[model samples]
Target: MVKKDTALGTGTMADRITDDEFERRMYSHDIAPLPKEMEAIFNTMPDFVVRPKSAKEVSNIIHVAQRKKLPVIPRGGASWGLGGCIPVKGGILLDMSTMDNIIEIDGDNLTATVEAGITWKKLCDTLERKGYFLGAYPSSAPSATVAGWINTGGVGIGTYKYGGAGDMIRNMEVVLPNGDIINTGFDYVMPNGSGYNLNWLFVGSEGTLGVVTKVTFKIYPAPEKFESISYSFNNLKQVGAAIHDITRAPINPFHMGFGDAMHYEYLRKVGIKAPKVGSLLTVTFEGAKEIVKYEEKVVDSIIAKHGGKSLGTEVGAHEWSSRSYEFKVRKMGLGAIPGEILVPMNTFSKVLDDTAKLIKKMKLKVPMIGSVADRNSVMVMPYYLTDKRKFVRSLTTMGFNKKFADIAFKHNGRPVGLGLFFACNVEKMFGREGSNLMHEIKSAIDPNDIMNPGKLVRTTTGFGFDAPGFAMNMGLGLLASVRSLLPRDTFGEKK
Candidate 1:
C-alpha cells in the first residue's frame, strides 16, 4: 500500500511501484505505435507505474490515487490499438499484467476463477488441461487479458455460438475508484432477475468504471470434436451474402471468419502461406462428433447454393489457427490501424461494397477481414497499412478511421469502441442524453474523475483542455478530405 505523500508515490505494495522515467515511458502506449508528434496533443506518458499482485494491493493503490487525486489507468496486456490504457494527464498507471494467477478451477461447478490479468490463451490452455473448455475467448488471446477484452469490445471467438466474454463471466472482483472492493454476480450460478446487471455495467466500460481484479467464468466440459471447413467466394459481397445465408440457417457455428483475396495477396506478399482464393470464409463447429459432422454437411450445401467452392479441411484448420496473428503483414510497413465496426446482416454487403470504394477513393493499400459477431451482427476490420515513420504522413492516416466510422454510421452500423481516437462519437452512438448520462455516471462513480480521465466520454489533453466535440468531428473530416487529394500509395507494390 502507498502512503499518503505530496511529492510522489511512496510506501510499498510489495515494493512494485516505479517512478523511473525509463519504465514510465513503456506504460505510455498500448499496441498501437503512435508517432512522437502526438505528444503535442496529449500526455501519453505516465508519472508512475505500479504492478499490483493482488486485489488488496490494487485497492491499496487506488486509495493512494484518491488521496493524491491522480488518475489511475489500469493496463493489462497492452494489446489494444486504442488509447484506452494511455494516461493523458501522466498519473499512476496500474500495470495488471503481473497479477495473473488462477485462484480456483471449480470443475464440478463449471467455473474457473482467475485474476483479471490472466491472458485468454493462458486461461484457455489451463482449462483445456483439466478437460474444460473456454467457450468464448478473444482472437488476440495470445496477449489480450481477460479483463482487457471484456473492457474493449466484449466480443470475439465463439461469440456467434456461445456469446461473448460477458456471457461466460459469472462474477468479477472490482476495485472502485474510491478504493472499495466489490463483487458483482454470483459464484457458480448465472446471475439473473436483478434490477440491473452490475456485471454488465463494468463490461465494455473501458476501465473507466473500476479495476477488475478477479473474475469467475463459466466453463464447459471439453467438446468431443472441433470441425473446421473453408469455402471460396468470387468477391467480398458474395462472401457477405453467403455469411448472411449461413447465419440465417438453423445451425450455429462455433466460429466463422472471412478474408478477401486482396488481404491474402498481401499476406502472401509477406511470405505467409495463405490460400490464393479470391475470398475465403472459414467456419468451425464444436460439439459431439456426429453433430459437428452434420453441421459440416449443412454448411457445405449452403456454400454450394451461394456459388462457393470447398477449400478442404487443411486450409480451414490453417485459417482457424492463424486467427490471433491476423496482421502478420504489419512487418511490411508500420502496423495498421484497424477500424473495427459492427454492422447488421442486412447492410453487411453494402458496407463491404462501400468500404472497398472508400479505400480506393482514399488511395490506400488496405485489406479487410471480417467475422460473424452474432447471428445478426458482423464485425468488419479494415487494416490500412501506412508508414508511421514518416511523421506527417502518419498523421494523415488517422483520417481513414474517421471516414471509416462515417461509412458505418451511414449504413446504420458503428465503430467497435469509443477509445481515445473515437471518443467524439459517443453522442452519435449513444445519443446526447445517453452520452451526458454516461459522463454523469462516470463522475458519480469516480468523484475525482481520475480513473482513466481522457478516454471514451471525451478526450482531454495534458494541458487540461477537452477536445471540443464539434472540433473533433470537424478536424477528422478535414484530414480525411485532405487525404483523398493526396497521391496514391505504392509502398507495398512490387517495384
Candidate 2:
C-alpha cells in the first residue's frame, strides 16, 4: 500500500523532485479513471515525481534511478487511457509536460525541432500563424504530447497521405536507458543512408526503450486549399465499396474517415450536430484550389459509382473540425472505454458487421468509427459506456475490448496500443522469434528492468506476480460472459 502521510516527501530526493502526497496523487493517473478496487493490484502512486526542464536533468534522474534500482516512468501530458504511464510498482515518475518548448523551426528546410513535451495543438496553432503545419498528429492533439503520440502509433489526420510519425521524423534526440544521449538521424538531412534506421525503433517503443527529449520532425507548408467533402451511403456495403474503390482510384486524399449511423446517433445523444445518415465517408483534399476541385470531382464519381449521395462541403467541414473529439460522448455521465483495431480494406465490411453484432451480444449501445491509415490498412474504434459506480460490473466490461481484439485478430488485424493490460499480446502481435527478440532487446538495453518495467516486455503486478497470456484471455472471457448476463446498462438510452 502507498503511504498516506507527508513523510515520503522528506526523503533524499533532490529539491526539484517532490514526494508531496497531493502532487503524487494527481500525477498517478492519466485520464483512464480506473476503479479504486484496482488499487489492490497496481500501485499507481510514485515514490517521487519530478519535472525535468532539460534532457540533462532527465539523465541525472535516470542515473539516480539506476543507482537505486528503481523503475523510472517517463511521462508527457499523460493523456493516454492505457496504463502506459501508470506505475505497477512504486518508483520515480518523470513528468515531461512542463518542459514544453519550441526549440527551432527551419522554414527553408521545413522542419520543426521541439521539446518532446509540447502539445500537438500548441505546435500546430503556432505553425499555422507562420503558415506551416505537421504532416500528421494525434487525434487528441489538444492535450496529448508530441512524444506521447509518437511513442504510440503516430497515425492520425494526414497519415493516409503524409504517413506516420516514423516517416516524418528527420532526427530524434533520445536519452538511452543508461543515461547516454544519442541522435538517431541527421538534423538537416534525410535519414535514409543508414544502419538500423534507429528512429523507427523508438517511434513506437512506448518509453520502454528510452526517453525522447527532443525531436526534429519534417513539416509541410499549409495547403492552398484544404477542404473536406462527405457522402452518405444507404448501408455498409456501399460505404465499404466507396472506401475500397477510393483506395484503388488514381487520386490520394489527405485523409479519410467514416462512421456508421449509430456512431452519429451517440454524438447527437450528446448534442453534437452530426449528419443523420446510415453511413458516410468524409474525405479531405488538399493542394491548389484547382487541384482540390478536380479531386472532388473524381471522388464524387467514385461515390456515385457506389450509390452514395453527397453531404456537401458544410457538413464535411464540421465533420473535419470535430474529428479530434469524436468520442466526446463520454462526457454524458458514464465511463467510456474505447477499443481500436486496424484491418485491411477487404475485411472492412465484415469487421463493422461483427462489431455491430458484438455490441448487441454484449448489450452495448455505443457505436464504431473508422479512418483510413494508408493504402493497406484502416483503423476502427468502438466505444462502450459503462456505469463505473457499479464497480465489479464495470470492470467486467473490459472483456468487450478483449473480445473486440479477437474479432480484429480473426480479420487479420490487431489492437493499437499495448500498455499494461494488453502486454500479454506481445508474443501474438509479433511472431514467436520476433517477440523473443524484443524481450532480448529490452533486457539488453535495460538490464535492470528500470525503464518502465512490467509493461510491453512483460506483465507484472505490484506483487511481483507475472500474468500468463492464456490465463489473462480466459479471465477476460469469463468476465465478458459475466457482464453479458448482468442486467443491461440503461444509461443514455431512449425511453
* Alpha-carbon runs more than 4 Å astray in model 1: 1-14
Candidate 2, which ten residues in sequence have the lowest lDDT sum? Answer: 1-10
TM-score of 2: 0.95
Question: How does model 1 fare in lDDT?
Answer: 0.86
- Find the candidate with the highest lDDT and give its number: 1
Error of 2 at 98 (Å): 1.0
Q: Identify the candidate with maximal TM-score.
A: 1
Q: Which residue pairs show collisions in model 2?
A: none
Can you write out model 2's per-residue Cα lDDT over 1-495, one digit (the tens) per residue? 233233222333356677788988887877765777776888778888888878888887788778777788988877777778888887889888977899998999999999999999999998989999888887889999988988886678889998987888899899988999889898888888749888888987888999999999888889898999988997766888888988998888999988878778878889999889998799999988998998899999999999999989998999989988887888764657778888899998898888778777777676677789998798887777766677877888888888888888989998887787887677778878989999899989899889988887687788867788778778888888888887776767666
Task: Give the Å shift of residue 143 in candidate 1.
Answer: 0.4
Q: Give the TM-score of candidate 1.
A: 0.97
Report the error of model 1 at residue 459, Å.
Answer: 0.6
* Candidate 1 weakest ten by summed lDDT: 1-10
Q: What is candidate 2's local distance difference test score?
A: 0.83
